[model samples]
Target: MQEHIRQLFSENIQTMIAAGESLSGPLENAAFVIVNNLVSGGKVICVGEGATSALASHFCQLLLDQFETERPCLPALALCNQNNSLQHSHQQDYLARQIKALGQSQDVLLVVSSSGSEPSLIKAVEAALTNDMKIIALTVDGSGELSGLLNQQDVELKVPAHRRARIFECYTFLLHTLCELIDMTLFPQQGDL
Candidate 1:
């Protein structure tokens, strides 16, 4: 059992290393977009489905609270925390409505989907586009529908793996990296301590 567990950890680490090599540029660009939006007094809206919902909420929490060092609270919201009625709504139109109502041209919309084919997430992306918000998608390879939807203006950090669990694990690291980058950019004096 211990050997199996060790193998799993080793495989996951290898996947993460491969993801880092391929996604570093896109991740950095996404961080820049997020930092620039916040610096300009814009907000960040995060949305996701299933396990990714937790990640979306965590991203918002880290930004609204703090990731590492002391700094002013950044504006961020996670759509996954919507009321139960919205969560249970038919076809998740409520989420799309919320985005349409709250999203602004200057805001950034961060969407996470391992499969990159959740209908609700796609709707949220459409609403964000209608509102002229920038989009940053964290998804895995072979994300056909989601990849097709992204335009030149959008940033897609498509991890090189196909398994959902592996993609999500990579996302966890990417989120931490994003927070660190934001802190470093905003507070260079902190020195990443």
Candidate 2:
């Protein structure tokens, strides 16, 4: 049991280290994308597949409540929150509907998913594009069709792992890193925090 647990820890650490270099440029770019939208008075719209939506909500909470700072709340919301999904998951267009209703051309859609293959997620990406919104997708390295759908304006923090658990773990870490970068960039007193 101990060795098994240690191996799991090792795998996660290794994945994060490998991702350090690969994801830096894209992640930094994503931070600027988000910062640009925010400073422009546009909000962030977060969505995801299955349980990943919880991560979306958590991110919104972090942004809205405060990400290790006392600065003003950043505008953000989760289109795929538990209640919204429960009320509308029956329709494939659920997320798209919300995006069309609330999304603005200046908004950034932060899409979180382990596998980027869900039909609904694909539809969500298409909807965001139609709205002229930028996208920041946090997904596994080889995440399928959803990645293909992203245009040059979009940023993808592709996790450098094949295992779903590892990818999800990386998402959490990456999200934290992203939040820190945004906070430090937007609020410069962070001093290498």
RMSD of each: 1.8, 2.1
lDDT value for model 2: 0.87
RMSD of 1: 1.8
| Candidate 1 residue lDDT tens string, 92-126 | 66567889999998999999887877888888888
* Cα misplacement distance, residue 137 of candidate 1 (Å): 0.5
Q: Estimate each model's TM-score.
A: 0.93, 0.93
Output the worst ten-in-a-row residue range by lDDT, candidate 1. 81-90
Off by over 4 Å in 2: 81-90, 190-192
TM-score of 1: 0.93
Clash counts per candidate, in order, are 0, 0
For model 2, residues 156-193, the per-residue Cα lDDT tens digits are: 98888998788878888888888888898888885255
**Cand. 2 TM to true fold:** 0.93
